[model samples]
Target: MPDGNGTFVKDFFIVGFPGLHSTYYFLVSAVLCLVYIFILIANGMFLFMFATNKCLHKPMYFIYINLVLSDVLFSTSTLPKIIARYLFQDGTISFSACFFQMYLVHYFGAVSSYTLAIMAIDRYIAVCYPFGYHAIMSNRNTLILSIVIWVFSHPISIMMVVRAFPLPYCGTNTIIHCYCDHVSITRLACTDRAPYSFPAFVFAMVILLGSLAIIVFSYSFIIFAVLQISSTHGRLKTFSTCSSQLIIIALFFLPRCFNYLAANVGITFNANLQIVIILLYSLLPPMINPLLYSLKTEEVKKILISKLKKHQVHLTVLS
Candidate 1:
């Protein structure tokens, strides 16, 4: 369906802080700018270290590389546009571009979820069946798993975006959220949005909850396995390996649970608080994950420190 001009709504205005005073726009934009910078620098360093350090050429590190890649891509998909909207006072996004962004936002998100589950599986094998971990999680198999996660996660997002694009959109074109998403776009349809919204919601649950179930299963076995260790120090060491991963998974999944439950179960809460939680959880994992791994994982941290020492020694020699 087309409007008077015989075309769908060509563009949409992204509304950030709908009733925010104009005075606070710059302050908001500046803070977001700092966050975007940190996300890039932090994730970028992990990617660099993974590629350059031969010590990181194992199945576990390979999975982490994909996670880093997803975080970088996911952050890039939405942050720049939001920042530009606040700073330049331009919120208009072409209709096609909005859909494109929406697709990416979910695509990378799904990939990250699946990859995290795969990582848990990796850890599960390493701990519970250490003798067979290598045979079970070969480097070639790890690479293939990463590739499969990226490729297979595309279709659901594709279906959601394609379903929404051709529907009649004659009324208000303002998307109330900071970014375009399946829900935001479908909610704008002039016709009843049930067909697209229902299928999309089902798929969203399958991906988010399905991946989460796998993680939960893996960790249950992990906990039981840890408890059976004969020595207290041995139990502590094994648990230490999973501490950062547990933190990362909790931050990733908990807010998502709150969000989906609020939508489906008809729970009442502040709309602003909902937005804050979504934004915080999405950005929080990426921001903190690099620091968590570098500090918590001894091998990577040692390699990083060693590289820094070498660089300093080289500088001193030059001086």
Candidate 2:
């Protein structure tokens, strides 16, 4: 029987890992709790630094701030409930809440994809047209672009959720993966899901490959520009500037592309293996990004050292 809201199933169960032994639940939950804590402390520190430090207000940092926000919000939306599930053996989520989580998962994902593309653009301009880089990628323009990325990411994500949410999910109410997402939720639809699934797949590919194409194109130009530089040191310096972004990009995008492609194609993965891969790509980047920025970017590194020195002095004075 359908509820007043027309959902046949009023809630869904999020099974973190179907095969896990009961004895190890506490261990798994504790590890996840630590990861969540690290993500917050790392990203929150970067956010605080950016907010207080005006010298950090450049186009690249502006784009990074957007990425940081998306990373934090995404982690927040997904981590708590899953942690609770393992900690308390409670995996239940209400109908509306499940869909809301799905929306946020996709929304932040889309934002991250676009932000990475914008990051590539920032680097492309910096490397290829050094003289005009500042003029082209001014703070105001970068902020506007960040706003546009956030605004534009909503439509398709909302449509994916809206299209999938109203479907008849009268079958099993257990979501197989760690978090609520479109595919996991829609798999339970009572009706044939081909029509719905295909469109969602297309939208996902467009977001992933579209942004990926931009990154690829921009880096192609950057490579050409770097090669033309006469001095090895000049080329090395330029490449070093991009190394962190490239590392983050590879971590975030490559595994995701492989997973999406593998699923759509005939290749199959073990259920646990698939879930682990998803977690690797989804969670690792956010945890690693702050460290990458602090270590790789010279300005950020210098400022961080300065702040640490000041803190040390304050501690010494207090003692």
Candidate 3:
């Protein structure tokens, strides 16, 4: 059936929000541009600081640098083309390019999930096993963990994309979402998508849920450890440190869970609303992570402040 339906789709039209009114495309495009700009600024700042500041090179920040890389790649994979699609009316993407985008879209996303879980594990060790934290999460081991996450998470996404790539996509060439992805691409194929779709969905769920489980498990122990602290001061301080991560986790996971439910359960949801949900979960995390994760750390905050002050002083002298 690969060629039974007709010519194989050589390219795909990224039909972002097909239901959206044409007149409002400008407004939507502007908003997307703003979010895209913020994502670049926030994540870029972290990467610059991490690379320039020798003191920032530690196990924790190593994991963060990895997240920054993934976020940059993730945003790059989707945003630039979508921006052009909106601003220039150039929505057509080559078939192979679309699949490659699908690979990176899923790969970096899974890497972020796994990287976050690694962060949670890092926090758990720091909180629960304070004495051995340094030895357990040594710089070398942390580097290895980050490398393993980048290396291994890729193949899982490859499996999902490979299954869909060979299927005959002879039907509609319009992708409903902003970018190429497993579900949107596979659903358009001529073949019975169940063979391809079901496994991919399950695999996606397993990655989502498994990483979330690890985070939850780590936090559970962290919470238990926090309770045993003797002073209210200690308890509040410990909990405060974790609050930002909890917010990031909720922002990233909750909307995604809802999107999955809406997709699979035959629930009638507005198409624009679905796109908005997708944007919220993916875009907000990277934009805010620099603040919530990096700046939240006292050491990083101090370093950033010192750097900013120095820059301001130099600017004043120049003026």
Candidate 4:
């Protein structure tokens, strides 16, 4: 499937959305398209609701905005290519184009991981040291910290693309997944990938497990603090904030652990299994993040309700 260029080539492949009746590609495509449409509209509405509504502007929601933005990037980076491949029988991407694809997908992924870690620390401070939270997480400090995470994620992702692309390709350049994933693409590399894979593995461990450890430690103390509170009401309020964060962190961290660990060890290459994990990775976390955050916060709910009522009124007047 490689194109005419001797150095690098990837012209076309039959990938994305398999295991339906041939008659159902059209139906399947329609369903996937609808899913994608809702993802954009719903996530976009959350982003808009957060940005314009001053009431929702706090350290938590500010972090949520970053999360939403990353999710939007995360969803778009792979899904469009996926939809394209299904709609058109063949799809082509140049070497450099593949590199950029790798960068965007992983870059935003790392961004999301880093942001979740930040959110965990934010909650830790809020719950553990309620009085000191505001002073510690000033607007300026949070802004600088966000910038640093993005800056840090870039070099690592770039290295991944640089390391993976130079390897020799024999015949078909088709990547099994819709997007060019770091590990899957590396497997195809003609050269040994220890130099690239090792560093990436280390980074993954630091970001995934390391973050999990911090979150666990923070929450352990948080649980202790909650138990000490005599009033049931106070404890419930505290748990609500921690609950949504816990859900998001677990979803993001677990698959990463599975992917890195499973691949490092010699595992069976069940194509169906791989596709399921990849789809869960690509789709689930981003889709659920906005839903979880919006559901957890009453402020967000009120704003959404108000917006809905106003829109309904407008429609009625027009009619």
Name the better of 3 and 4 by lDDT. 3
Error of 2 at 310 (Å): 2.3
Residue pairs whose backbone atoms clash in candidate 3: none
Q: Tens digits of per-residue lDDT for model 1 on 1-319?
A: 1234334687888886667788998998998889989999999998888888888889988998888889989989998898898899888899899999999989998998998899899989999999999998999999999999999999998998889888888777888778898877888888898777888888988998999999999999999999999999999999899999999999998888778767766686665666677789888999998999799888788988898999999999999
Residue-level lDDT tens digits of model 3 in 113-144: 89889989999999999899999999999999
State each model's CA lDDT, in order. 0.88, 0.91, 0.86, 0.76
For model 3 the TM-score comes to: 0.94
Q: What is candidate 2's lDDT per residue for 111-217, written digit by digit as tens?
A: 99999999999999988888999899999999999999999999988998899988998767888899999888888898888899788888999999999999999
Model 3, 252: alpha-carbon shift in Å? Answer: 1.5
- Backbone clashes, each candidate: 0, 0, 0, 0
Q: Give me the overall lDDT of model 1.
A: 0.88
- Give the residue spans of candidate 1 off by over 4 A: 1-8, 311-319
- Candidate 4 Cα outliers beyond 4 Å, as residue runs: 2-14, 17-22, 311-319
Model 2 residue 83 CA deviation in Å? 0.3
Error of 2 at 217 (Å): 0.4
Q: Quick one: ranking by lDDT, best first?
A: 2, 1, 3, 4
Candidate scoring better on TM-score of 2 and 4: 2
**Local error of candidate 2 at 4, Å?**
19
Report the C-alpha lDDT of model 4 over 297-316, residue by residue, as the tens digit: 89988887888999999999
